[model samples]
Target: MIGQQAIRDWLFINGKIEKAVHILSSLHSPDDKVFVNRKEKDGSTSKVPCPLALKDYNSNMNFVDNFDRLKKDNQCDRKSHKWYMRLFFHFIDCCVVNSFIIYEELDTDGKKLTNKNFRREVYTGLLSRKLVDVQSPSILKKRTKSTTEISNHKPHVSKHLRLTESKHQPTQISSRRCAMCSTKKKPQRTK
Candidate 1:
């Protein structure tokens, strides 16, 4: 079993928790520390002292719960199916939550908006900023007619051609061909 001193030492290493505990202790008043009668499992009500940290912890948890709920309601990170996209989605969710909190904090006199509504408004505002007037769709239809017309196009030269062009026999073996390339056949379409 761990001793009380060990637990205290562990708490000391956690700077944020230590700072919060110190602040709570400073603000603590005798009247503020009220004991509420809690019913026990054995059928007895006992006056239990509620710590300041419990309230702070619960409030912080509530904020996180709200942030998660808002993220779930208005998800915008499904643009790609790749695994790496999850990181981007999480980042976007964090940004939305932070922006919503900042908006709420700034507007002291305005009616408080729910997390869902706040997220929707933020998304709509972003979409509004990106909206542009398109002159014509015909501009995007232009394409190079042939491979020769493309400036960046390079013709694929076979390994045999390279060996013939070079006077010295290649000391190194040509790189192993890809499995698909060795087949020398196009994939058949299902439909």
Candidate 2:
């Protein structure tokens, strides 16, 4: 492949001047141009100016092939009938690969992480981060209750016991997100 740094050179093949070439380096960038043979609609061989990257791609594709191989080695692909979900998993795999590339660049220690290990570390880190609740307090104030409590069938409180207890203070109640409801679905409209 013709790299971005490769010097400009010309080659004559079949009497057409072919531009740059690549041998020892990776594929060339999309900046420069090269003349290559193209079949005309009239069944005549024509010289076409092709992008160096395109020419390099036509010759040998190592970058994309290597990246695909790396991603496939430890992919986050999930079996899903939904096209969007499959795309989402593939997106996740791409993100992992991107992050791994950045990590490789920033890493200075002698010890380096493999792509699989990097993905594992990333998964563990995501699982380990503290999750924050974004639900509003108004929605959280009302929570699920037992049928007996909801029916208001509590035993009558003794006047003396109530007087002895601090009625002015509010009691703290534990609340959590419901499995069957959210801010959007199953909104709590009734007390």
Candidate 2 lDDT over residue span 24-128, tens digit each: 323443356789998877999988776665666566668678678888999978899999999999999989998887888899886799998788678756651
The candidate that achieves the highest TM-score relative to the unseen native structure: 2
| All candidates: TM-score | 0.39, 0.40
Ten residues in sequence with the least summed lDDT for candidate 1: 1-10
Name every residue pair that clashes in candidate 2: 2-28
Candidate 1, residues 1-191, lDDT tens digits: the string is 11111232132111232233322233333234345566888999998665444445545778789778867777667767787898888898889878877888898777888887787667656652312222233543564353544556443333564445432342433654444444547733333
Q: What's the distance in Å from true for residue 126, model 1?
A: 3.3
- The segments of candidate 1 whose C-alpha lies over 4 angstroms from its true place after superposition are 1-8, 11-45, 49-56, 77-83, 108-117, 128-191
Candidate 2 TM-score over all chains jointly: 0.40
**Which regions of candidate 2 fall more than 4 Å away from where they truly are?**
1-54, 58-60, 129-191
Error of 1 at 55 (Å): 6.3
